[model samples]
Structures are given as structure tokens and as C-alpha cells.
Target: MFDLDLWREIFQSINKNKTRALLSGFTVAFAIMLFTILFGIANGLENTFEKFFIRTAENAITVRFGTTSKPYKGLKIGRQVRPSNKDLDYLEKEFGEDIQYMSPKISRNYQVSYKKQKGGYTVTGVAPDYQYIEKAEIKNGRFLSLKDVNNKEKICVIGRLVEEDLYLKESAVGKYIDLEGVQYKVVGVYSDGGGDSQERVIYLPYTTIQRLYLGKDDIGDISLTYNPNLTVDQALALVEEMTIKLKNRFDVAPNDQRGVRIGNQVLTAKKRLDNISSGLGALIPIIGFGTLIAGILGISNIMIFIVKERTKEIGIRKALGASPKSIVSIILLESILITTITGYLGLLIGVGILESIGSSLERYFITDPSVSSSLLFSATIVLIIAGTIAGFVPAKKASKIKPIIALRNG
Candidate 1:
């Protein structure tokens, strides 16, 4: 089906108006290129959120109690909402099977000092289950054991920051560090790096903090893991129910004292990504369509003018027994050939630029971004259709002109 003459004419016409054609084709390519990059960046962000949240148990809900600003139900304003061991025990008994992992957190900013070398770091109270639920990575030794918690052992897990500060000159495992005059054995070192959901935390046992320091048994927060495949409505309802039940058991206002906060606010990060991805998904088509229309219009206009300039030649071809379909097919093939070649080139350049700039741009906000082949294929298909249609109308009009009239006009 490939005609050598038709291809020769397509190349000749494009070569004749090289600058104009190149500029027009570049327009079409630019539109698709922008869409492709945006789509990839959006998917990357969604992936980042997925990696951060989806690796753990599906229905994982975290509980945090912060100070309430207002006095509710005859209570003082700015009341601190602290969670106790009783609330942890109660939730465990209540949500038993529905929950997969239940871990309590006790976090505070402290200066972990080993005499001369001291640095500010976060001290977290965590148990063995914290590793599974939060996905903590240990570089050496091991995390706090059940025995550590049960026996109130004065052993701590150091973070990378602590390692750099306390034993930066040496290995952190089996090192001793001070927590405000309390000396604890460094049993492990965790390498979590840093993330939006997770921070650099040095973990110790809850009982160790309470029994060793003669402090209260108040836990900072609670982490509950559930199935994540549930719907947004289902997740919200479950957390809402759990929060009410917890408040009632503690005889505190759900909005105030004995207060507890439930639900993964970071799960709502999915909302942010979904918004961008869906919006960009929709926008890509609009831009592609717009560029397609412009390309079609340009090719149609140029072909109509070319036919007008070649009225005498068209008249001679008609008189020489050229069929209407032949005339139209000739023009359409030229248009399509030009568009297909230039459009592909533009796509390559655009994709190259995107690949080049992607990592550099992602550091600020977007994560790893890359385009999909399906989307590019779809764009190419659209360009081909536009080119064919643009040529068809003009070519058909040229074919209908009478030999006598075209000859006279020329």
C-alpha cells in the first residue's frame, strides 16, 4: 500500500515550507510533551505516598491526643489530652480481631549526650510490634523486645542522628548514651532516613521510661493497623467509632479532656495525589485535542491554498483520467506523512527533555516521574487521524473542479 510517488511529494512539499511546517509540528509536539511529563510527575507523587503508607497493615489507624484549645462541657481551655496505658489496653480488647497491630509511642525531643559529643534527637518509646507496624529498619543489633518492655529494661535503640552525634567516630551498637542523667544501653540502631510520615526516632521501652525515670505511664500516641483496602467512608466510620468508644470509656469529652485523636491524616495524602492525578489525567486529553485541532486546521488551510495555486495542474490531472479518490488520497498521504514524521520527532525531543529535567525537578517536590508508552501511542494515533482528515476535505474540493473552469481561472 506504500506509494513511492506519494511519499516523494509529501517530502517535497514539507521541504518547500520547512520552517513553517516545522514550527506547526512543534506546536503539536509541545502540547503532548507537556501532558506526558505532568502525568508522569503526578504518578510519581502517588507512588511516593503509596510506598510510605501502603507497605504496612491495610486498616492501620494512629491515635494522638493533643491539647484542646477550648473548654468543652465545663472543662478548662487548653487542656492537655494525654493517653494512658489503660486506653491502650481498652482499645486492644475492643478492636481485637479488627486490628492487626497495636503499638504505643512516647516521643520527646532530647539532647542525647555522651560527654563531649552531644546532639538533639527524638527519643521514642516503642515495643517489638513497632517494627512491624511502622516498618522500622535496623542497621545493627535489634529493636526493643517484649522482655525489655515487661522488665522495664533501660536499653535504647539509636537513630542515625544519634549515631552521628554520640558515636559518629565509632559504631553505635553496644554504645551508652545519656537521657537527662538516665544512662541506657544502646542495643540497636535504626536506619529510617527521614520521611513525611516517619521521623528519625530513637526508641526505648515504655516501662523503661516509666520505671527508670519515675515518670508517669502516659504514652504519647497509639498506632493501630487495619486493612487498607477499605473505602474512604468505611475507614472514616471505623476510626470515628473507635474514637467515641475510647472517649466514653475514659469519662472524657470526645472533643476535650481524656481526649484521643484517631485516623491516618496521611491516608488523606491519597486525596491530594488523587486530585492532581485525576485533574492532570483529564487535562492531558484537552491539550492533546487542542493541538490536534490546530494541526488539522493548519494542514487543511495549507492544502487548500496549495490546491488553489495548482488549479491548472489539478484540471490537467482530472482530464487525464485521475479518479476523485486518487486525488484525495494523494493529498491525504502527503499530509499524514509530514505529520507522522515531525510529530514523532517532536515527541522524542519532548520526552528527552522530560527525562532530562525530571530528577532535577523532582527534588523540590515531585518524586520519581516517567511517561507511559500507552499515552504516547494514543497521541501519535490522534495526530495521524487529524492529518488524514485535514487533507481529505481540501483534496475532495480540488477533485470536484471542472477542467474547463480550472483551466480558465489559471
Candidate 2:
């Protein structure tokens, strides 16, 4: 089956029209190469986006309440809605076992100072659970404790960017910073590697943020996390039940009057991210296939021309007793060989480019742009199959050629 003469003939035929063969090979290579790069970029973009979101916590959820689009009851659409500490406590008691951590955040724009240095900031009030739920890492000192929250202690944590701007060094920990003219001790610092530049936030005990700054016990919203023991769907289902119960406890009516609002970033943002990733995974392949189809067409056109030129040669062989299977196999094998080599070369080039440019690409995008090994293997198989298909019609024509007619044409 592995005849040296057969391969020799193929080599000779390709050598006869070197430029044509080279151009055909290049077409296949270019298609595959372009496809690979696009796929790699898609992957890199997804990875970067996922990483940033991960720092905010994968399992955690965020809640926000604002004016609804439609009027509820007799109230206008712009009616303000707010939550309270009692609502947070109720939710915690109800879903504590199903959660990893919880926090209620209230944000305000204010100025902070340490010594003579001052920095403007967005201040947030959060419980100790904020650290776990936000995946926070303290660069120095410690986080807020229950004592801080219950006693309404005037202690705060600073963002990395804020620290550099106000302290000039990380040694600002254990020192007091004036927030809104009220002195609060700096307890810790966290990085803003999520690409938000940290927003210069000064986090304090939820109670301190409530009483001293906002002048109210009302909160913005609560953040919660569900246990990994359940599936995402299951966890979300339990949370939804708890959400309804908490809404009831807060005396939220059917139209949401006198009620607190709830929300989840894990359910909304994370779910959207999942949909985007899946869509890209499906879309990039379609693009690659379009390129492959073009390459297949080119290979097929050249094969047809090759058949036309070699009609007499093929007829003579048939007349001399070469079987139809042999003729078909020879042509198909030639196409397969060409497509495979060039496709592989294209894949290698694409991978090389991705390796060199992937990091920069990652910074620009939310996912990776490179294909997996299994995908490469699958693509190789597809290339070979495409080559065989391209050669089939010409091979069939050659097989059916009449010796007498072909001889006259020759």
C-alpha cells in the first residue's frame, strides 16, 4: 500500500508546476493561520475579563436598589428605595448556612487626610465579611472586627492607590486618617489590581459609615455568597427563596413600596460573562470554517485543472490495468499530503505569534486567542478530510476517462 513509485510520481507532478503548488499551499496556510490568530485573541480577551471579575469574587453576589422603570402602586417611577440593617440581619439568619460571607455597603464621596497629606475618595461602609466576599488581601495590619462594627469604632482601610497618594509609603497602617474632618485609624490596605485603579476608597465599619456619615441606619445594599455544596442553579434557587422571605420581612408590598431592594453580581454579571464566553467559543469556529471552505475551493479548482492536464496519462494507466480505486486513492492522497503539511505549518506559525503576542493581547481582551491541543488535532483531521473531498470529483473524472478519446486529446 505504501508504494515508493506512487510517492515519486506525486513529487514529480508537484515539481513540474512548483509555483502553482507553492501558491496553493500558501492559500491553505494563510487561511489556517488567520483562523488561529483570531481564535487565540478571543481566548485571551475572555481570560483577562474573567480574571478581573474573579478578584471581585466569583461566588459572591452584589445588590443594588434604584428607581424602577415603571410606577409601583401610586408612587412615581423616580421614587427612592433604600435598605436597612434589620433587613440584612434577617437575610443572614435565614440563609446563613447557605452562605460563605455577607456584607452591607454604603458609599459616599468624601476627602481623607493623614498628617498633612490629603486625598479625595469614595468611602464605603462594610462588615468584616467584606474581606472574604470581596476576595480582599490586606497588605498591612488587619480588617474591621465585630467590636468595631458594634461599638461603631472609627477605624478604616485604604485602597492601594489611596495609600500611595496620601501616605507616600505603606507605613500608614496603625496611623489615624481624618475622614470628613473626623479622625479614623487606618487598619489595612488592599490592591486595586482589578484595573479599577482602586477608586481611592476608605472602608469603615458598616455602623460607623451609617451613623457618622450618612446620619441614618439605612444601607445601600447587601452582598452575599452561597455555599459550593450546591450547583449554581440550586444555590441561586435557595437565595431567591431567601430573597422573597427577606422582602416579606421588610414589608415590601407587591409594588415594592416600603420595601428594600436586593441584587446579585454573581447571578447577573457572572451569568452574562458565561453567555459571552460560550458565544465566542461558538463564533470563532464558524469564522475558521469559513476560511477552510475558501481553501477547499482553491484546492478543488487546482485539482480539476490537474485532472484536465493529466487525462491522457490517467487513461493510458487505466488501459494498462490500473484500477479505479488506485486512481482515486493516488489523487486523494496527494491532496491530503499537501493540505496536511501546509495546514500544520500554518498552525505552528499561528501558535508562535500567539505565544509572542498573547500577554499584550490578554491585556487588551477578556479571553485567550490560542487553540487547544485537542482542537489542533481536530483541525488537522479536518484539513486532511477537506483535501480528500477536494480531489474526489477530479479523481472520479479521471477514473471514467476513455482511453481512445484521451489519447486523441494528448
The numbered model that scores best in lDDT is 2
Local accuracy of candidate 1 as per-residue lDDT tens digits, 1-410: 87788778767866887775676566556655665665666666656655555545445668877766556667676667777788778887887756777788887777778868877777778768887786778888999899999999889987766676577678878878888888888898776634532435678897777665537888878887764556666667777788788666544576653356676575565566667767766875576567656656666676666667767877887889988887777667766776777777767876787778877865656666666788777877787787677667777888899888988887
lDDT of 2 by residue, 1-410 (tens): 67999999888877886876787688778877887887777777677657756656677766666554455455565556677888777777877788788888888888778778886788889999988877677888888899999999988988878888888955878888888789888888886555554536778998997888678898887887778676667766876676567545544454552344445545666667778878987997789788777877877787787777778888888889989888887777778778888989998998998888776664565355667878776766776787777789878877887778877776
Off by over 4 Å in 1: 1-9, 17-27, 30-62, 65-86, 97-100, 108-116, 132-155, 174-188, 193-200, 214-218, 254-258, 263-333, 348-374, 392-410
* Deviating ranges (above 4 Å) for candidate 2: 1-15, 37-55, 58-60, 63-86, 108-110, 135-155, 169-171, 174-176, 180-185, 193-197, 207-220, 226-243, 264-337, 344-378, 381-410
CA RMSD per model (angstroms): 5.4, 6.5
Question: Candidate 1 — worst ten consecutive residues by lDDT sum?
Answer: 191-200
Q: TM-score for every candidate vs. truth?
A: 0.70, 0.64
lDDT of each: 0.72, 0.76
Report the CA-based lDDT of candidate 1 relative to the real structure. 0.72
Error of 2 at 79 (Å): 12
How much is 295 displaced in model 2, in angstroms?
4.8
